[model samples]
Every structure is written in structure tokens, then in C-alpha cells.
Target: MRRFCSVMLAGVIAGLGVGIGVKAHAQAAPLEVRVVVVTTFELGQDRGDMPGEFQHWVERYPLEQSFPAPGTEHGVLRYNAQDHVLGLVSGEGPSHMAAAITALALDPRFDLRHAYFILAGIAGVNPYKASLGSAAWARYVVNGGAAHLIDSREIPADWPDGFTPLQGHVPDEYPRPPLHSIAGDMAYQLRPSLVQWAYERTKAITLPDNAALQAHRHAYQDFPEALKPPHVMIGDTISSETYWLGARMNRWAERWVSYWTDHQGEMVTTAEEDIALCQALALQAKAGRVDAQRILILRTASNFDMPPTAITPATMLANAAHEENLPGLHAATDAAYRVASPIVRHLATDWARYKEHVP
Candidate 1:
């Protein structure tokens, strides 16, 4: 029965162009480091004021009426330098992120070698473990809601009571196969030499006093500029429309759901894009397409999916408002830009080895 269902699911995902298991060969020449940052909200006042740090690159490509498949309708920021080339797409979840990556990979312009993919955005954290303004560096991304209960569309009688067709299941144990944000094996491949290089580069960095840094004492004290250890990555796939229902399910589950509710005071269910993004990254690691040691996912925890005594539209709005404005949120965002730009810049500068690095 499970075998038959698996076949059907494969067909469905293929038809929808949703499953991203296949690899697309790069047509564009390879570059040093190919990095992709997927996010939601192209521009927003709450996140912080922006002279728009990536503006120069965006200006070079500018917005077109359209681009190409998967991303044909979306606005993409593309930049190509002698070092490396990158595409930054805005939008928060799995489908959008997968498509943008597909388009970029398939596009003749991008060189895929020695690539690093990053999903940077706001996330919901476990309240007890992290405060409002804390940042989490994901070591592995568990697909919290990737699996769904199967319902036979053809046989109405086969439908089980109390079960919604195609309804996603939230499992107790963290899902596997783990996506590698930091390629463990690959780090050793580039070890010693790369570590020495990194050491030399980081030796001069002066750690600035920041409130966000103070929050995660164990995580980032002496090495504010250094990449922190692996942390669990959970993507909020819950859409605004279904987030509440997801949150309620979270309450029943209690354990996993607390990560969401504790931050926002409500339940939000749905698979977030970063989860799948990280999953795809795991695939990349398996395929030997990217340098995992150089990759990292830096996210800010923003909402707690806890149910409130008095729930109202205004209350929900306030929760979201607070999530965005939280102290660590800005610090994480700023740190992401500050920390990531240099790596991207380094990859862009060294394009000669692009093909060898791209998976």
C-alpha cells in the first residue's frame, strides 16, 4: 500500500514540477562561489530602513517584465562579477525557493561550481531556548510537515474518517535525511589550508558590542565573526491562511509546536521554504555539487506559535508586528549581510575554479 502511494505521489510532484530531485546541468561557465539567498519581502519598512545593500547588483540587471521558467514572473536580483555570480530572490517558502533555484540553475548565465546556497529570514524559535532577539545557525533542516496522509481521489469509500486528503502530518521525531548547511566531509577536504586561510582573515576582526550577540552567549561569544556550530533548522511552511490551524495541531503535539507558539503566542502550521531549501541543499551535498564547509543558514527566530486566551485579528497582527521588530531580528539581518557579503565577494573574485565547485 505504501509502495503504491509512493508511486502516485511521485507522479503528482512531477506533474506539479514540485519535486526537486533531478540535477540540471549548468550552461553558463562556472564561477568560484555560487550563492543563493531566498527570502520573503523584497522591501519592508519594519525590517529596517534600506538604502538597499544589494542595490548596486540589482540595478545592473534591473527588473524586467519577466525572466524565465519557474522564476519568469518573479523579480530576481542577478549579479555577475569576475569572482562569482549570484541570484537573490524574494519570497519565503519552499515552492518559491525551489523554482527560483531551478530557474537560476537552468539559466545559461549562472556558473554552478563551488556553490553555496543560503536561506536567510525570520523563524520561530523555542521560547525557553531562545529569546525574542536570538539568531540560529541551522546545521540541519528537518522537514517538519513534508509528509502528508494519502487519500485515494478515485475511491471515495477508501477515504478515512477525520482525515483530510493530502493533509500534512507533523511527526514527533525530527525528520531525516538531514540537510547539511555545513558540509562536514567537505570541510575536511578543504581543511587545514582553508582553516588557515580563514584564521588569517578573521584574526583582525574586532567584535563589536551588540545586544544580539549577548543573547546567544554559548553560541557566539569569542568568535562573533566565526561560523557557529550546527543548530536544528525548522521552516515555517504554514501560510497565513492555514497558520492558525497548523498552530492548533502544534498545541496537540506540544513538543515540536512549542517552537512556534512560544515565540508568537499562537500556532502556525505549514512547511516553510527554508526547510525544503535546506533539504535541496542536502541533496546538493550528496551529489557533491557544493562546498558544504563554506555554507551556512543564519535565521532569526520571530514568532511563538502559542495559542492565546483572547485571540482576535488585532492580536494576531500585534504578534506579527512584534516578531518583525524584535531586537535580534535586526541584528541577525545585519549580521547576515555583513558576514555573508564577504564570502560571496570572495567567491565572486575567484571565478577560475567555478566549474570544479558547482555540483
Candidate 2:
């Protein structure tokens, strides 16, 4: 029965255009690192690029040791023994994410059994729900790139959006694949209580808010809540490499989450790396190399998923760099660090408390 399901699922995944799986051999012992920081391009870039003191424990704890992935250039993993934190700079894409994680999982040097993995990065915010530079704790992560696309001109007139959730379908009518049936079959639901715990621990903290960001926020006045400065919230994420925008795409994002979670999901942030990272971790968990439930995703907004109505789509696309920088990349990164540091400190200082409890 299991083999039949796997073969049938493979055919479906091919049709959907999203491939899955990670190939890694089991090692003798898991890495002892208690906390692992998994970050995309920005966090994984050169250490000198870090704007301020707010950083992974790497800065204060300093790099105690480094493990160089054998077959790759600049794919070294750093560990801070003092704080029990490990860092991986997975380059910015699905491919790089899988490679980095596969290397670490198969390295045979680290016993990652009890390590708590934190997937943190900057994501485009749904301005209607969150402001620039706010941090969000995710309960559900969906792949925006998972959908089958039909050009707007090609799609049937009745279909409201150009995106079809899967092949041979129109908007709102895509078949719902059962769990483990295909790539992005179900929204990878993180541990709800852990998500709540992370948010409750950091929600009260202040985040980056500035006059320039406020002025930008003003443009989103129609989205009352987006007008506020950066803050912390618990929400869901949409992961896709394509930078989609506007009301049409916005509705698609919400629907995408709802489809995968069966009506319990909400799209709060848009990201490019979560699905890839989570998929890799899922593979590791299946091998007993890591605890899937220990993984947490925290995304801070560097820009909005859609520009305010005042801006034209063409202009929004042209000014992509400006939008990515307006709230200041530093501001978003800082917000993530602020909201996540205490959790880091708590875990490191009291590892025993979370060791067996898996909180």
C-alpha cells in the first residue's frame, strides 16, 4: 500500500512541477548542537555585513569551530560552543537550501538529534496584515511556487486569478491532494504551542519604527493595520520564488494557504525559502537526525507583498530595490533578532528544560 501511494504521488508531483526529497545517509551519532540558526542569503552572507551587535550568538560567542562541506565552495558551517548554536548560510534558493542541509545532515560530525532549528529570514509582508519590519511566527508555511500557472489571457474568463493550484484546473477548483501525496500537498504545520510560546515570549518587545518607514506605511492607510510601525505577530507564510503582487495575487495567497490547511490558514508574510528549508528538515526528521517539531520559522518584513494602490505595478516592479531598502534591511533584520534573542538565550542557558520537553 505504501509503495503504491509513493509511486502514484511521484506521478502527481511531476505533473505539478515541484520535485521533493533529500538524499542523505545516516551517521553514527547526531550533532550535539542544541540550537541551529538556518538563514537565507542575508544572514549567511559575509560576517562583516552584519549591521550591528544584534546577531546570531556567533558574534558574542564567536566562532568556536567550523565544518567545511566537502564538495562546495563557501559552504562552511559554523558553531558556537559556548551558546550551543550552529549556523548555516543556505544560499538564496531551493537548490542551495537542499544542498546546505543535506551536507550538514550527512556530515557525520554533528549529532543533531536534539538541536532546535530556527529558520529566520526577511520576507515580503502582506501590507494588509503586517507592517514593514515586523516579525511573524508561523504556524503554516505554503509554497507560492507550487501552483500551476495559466497566463491571465489563457485562463478561462470565469477564473478570477491566473494561478491554478495544480495542472488541468482553474482557480478555486484545484484538487486537494491528501497529506504526503505530492509536493506541497499540505501546509507544513509547525508546532502550534511552540509557535504560541515564541510569540508570547517576544510579542511585547518593540521593533523597528521610523519616520521614513511611517511615511511609507501611510501609503498603506487603506490597510489600517499596515499603517502601524513594526511589531511582532503570529501568522502564516507563503513561499515562492516569483515576486507576485496586487489584490489578485493577494487573494491567491490567502486561498493557497486555505487550500493546504483546509480553511484554517491565513497568509501573513510571503517568503522564498521556508518551503525549501522545511522540506529539507522534514527529510532529516524522517531519518532520526533531527526533531521536526523543534524547528521554528520567524520571518521579518523587508518589504510588502504588494505596493500601495498609489503606486503602479510597473513602478512597483522598477522600484523593487527601493522598496526592499525603504524600511532599511537592517531594520527588519534587527526586529527578527530582537524578538528572537531572548528565546535564544533562554534555550542556551537552560538547555535541560527544553532538552526532553522539546519546547
Candidate 3:
């Protein structure tokens, strides 16, 4: 009986040791991530009901794991463990985007050192460049909000508009001796090779079109590009917190992008969060938490930044306020997923090939 009791005690000790070892292993190693899909907002429940920028990814990729994401607009982050893909909603504006991205990057449960990030969302497209539902891969993301603004009525008659670059007395003035020395926060230039690769791969995709979209495009009869069917293109994005509209603002967006990129970028998509998102990612890259070169910004056209000739900007803005039934909303969301998913899948499935060298 004494021998039997001693053997039982020994067995219990061994089991306890194994349990502790497993727990320690789990605590020391974080989950490896391949790709992270970042979206701006969602309309309702993730699975059922109306779709937004995030719904298609969640339901289609079918992210099966839920991890608590404190301090984010959405309380939880979705994960597909099999594919090693994670989905995040950064809310609608710059503030929310900064907070959500920072929170995700700092989370202890994720290993993001080599993970690729894709910011896929909808934006107001420049009718002169692309039509509704078109997907654009941005090469440069310029901040339109970081400017010196004066009342249009009070500006000099010779000036183009009240907007000017920071520390500049006039519009479009080059502030520094070397243009490349401009503040890092003013703009983010993406890898041209990677941008070209993505654009080439997805440029031929045919985006969805309907009677409403057809009728809407017809209003922009003067703009040839707006009348064409939705397709993928390489364009730049301008981000501002204030949702400004009209022809004047459109022209400003074009000029802003040109000034920041030294005439290399053409503004196609206007959004509210990309600049802040980039800022956060850049900081994380500095901290050795992520790879900045692996970032990609994809925006689909949900609406036109300027109104048609027949309507005034005020009227168009008012109409857009009731965007739940907007015709381009669904098309843009679908296009974002269609255009971005191919790259995501390629990276996640062929991790061995792309883990060290970005393809």
C-alpha cells in the first residue's frame, strides 16, 4: 500500500509539471499573423443584415476567432486562425483610426513583425479620374487637413484659395530647401514597385454595375473617365477629417497631392482616415513591431467628390447624408473585397515565398 501511494503521488507531480509547462509555453509565444485587413466602419451586425466596408471580409473570409480589442471602435477583433488573417475596424475618422491601429499594434497577443497590412475602404472618387465603384491602389497618401486655412472671402484675389501649406504664406509654396525634407506627417510615399505589382494584378477586374450606377454616371457626361465602367487603377489618396465637397475642393485635392508628391501622384480617392492610419503604422514600424513596406492602401469609389453639372454642391451633400440607400455603397464595398482579397490570399497561402521578400 505504501509503494502504491508513493507511485500515485509521483504521477500527480508529473501531471502538474506538464500543465505548468504548457501554460508557460502559451504565455511566452504570441500568435503569428500573416495578413491584417483594416476597414473603416461597418453598418450593423458582422454576419447578417446590411453590409459595409468590413462585413464582406468577415462573412466571406469567415473569421472564426474573436479577440478582445480594448479602446477600439469595435470591441472585438476577428481572426481566421487557419489562414492567419486578422480583421480590424478602425471606425470612421482620423482619431478613431489612430487609436484602433495603435491598440492593435501594441497588443501582446499578436506577432505582427512580418505581417502585411491592407487598408481597404470606400472613398469619394474624383470623377475626372475614375467612376463610381472603381478600386484605386494609392501610391501616396497626403494629408489635406494639415494646412493653413483662411476664409475664402478674406483671401487675396490673386490666391487660388484660402488653403496653403504649413508655414507657407501663399498657396503651393515650397517650404523647405529640399522638397524631400518636408515633414514626414505631411505625406506617405508607398513602395512604387509594390503598388505597380498590385495595380497590374487587379487592374483588369470588372467591377459590378447596375442601372442606378449607370444612370448616375450619365450625369457626368462632360467627364469621359466618369462614364466608363468601374475598373482598378493606380491613383493617390487625400485624407481630411472635414468632409468637404464641390469643384473647388476637388481642385484643391489634386493640387495638394501634386505638391506633396512633387507632381508624381494624381489624386483619385478622398478619405477621412488613411493619413492617421499611416501615421500609426509608421510609428509601429519604427518600434520594430511591423514592416512599413508591407502596407497597402486600397480605396474604392463610393461617390463623386464633386456634384454633376445639373446639381449644386449643397444639394449633393444633403443627398449624401442619407447614404444608407446609396447605390454606389454596395458596389464599392464589393469591389474593395474583390480587388484586395487576391493579394491577401497570395500572401497568406504562400508565406514561405513572401515571408522574407515582399512579392
In terms of lDDT, the best-performing candidate is 3
Q: Candidate 2 — which residues are off by over 4 angstroms?
A: 1-31, 43-45, 50-57, 60-64, 70-74, 178-186, 322-326
Return the candidate ranking by lDDT, descending.
3, 2, 1
Error of 3 at 244 (Å): 0.8
Could you give candidate 3's per-residue lDDT for residues 1-359 as a string of tens digits? 99688667666866777434433553568888999999999998888888998889988877878888888888889999988999999999999999998998899999999999999999999999999999999999999888889998999998878988777778878653233434588889987888888888898888999999999999999899999999999989999999988999999899889988889989999999999988999999999999999989999999999998979999998889655755599999999999999988888998998889886
Better of 2 and 3 by TM-score: 3
Residue lDDT tens for model 2, 1-359: 99688678777876787755311221244558888777776443445655421244355445557777665434677777777788767777667777787778777788788888887777888877888888999999887777678777877777777776554365666455333345543369999888898889999998868787887788887898788878899989998877777777888898888877878988999877788878888888899988889878999988777878778766766777543343547777777677776787678779879988865
lDDT of candidate model 2 versus the reference? 0.75
Number of the candidate with higher lDDT, 1 or 3:
3
TM-score of 3: 0.92
Instruction: For residues 1-359, write the lDDT of model 1, one tens digit per residue.
Output: 99688678777877898865422321334444355544544443312244222332344322222233344334645544443445565455566665665555555544454565554455544333443333444433333442333333542453332222122233322232232442221111112233344334433433233544355433423333222322222222222212332234443323333332333222222225555454444455565554455544545544434323345545554645543444345554443344445545554455455334431
Q: Which candidate has the highest TM-score of all?
A: 3
Q: Would you list the C-alpha lDDT of every candidate in the order shown? A: 0.41, 0.75, 0.89
Clashes of each: 36, 7, 0
> Model 3 Cα RMSD, Å?
4.2
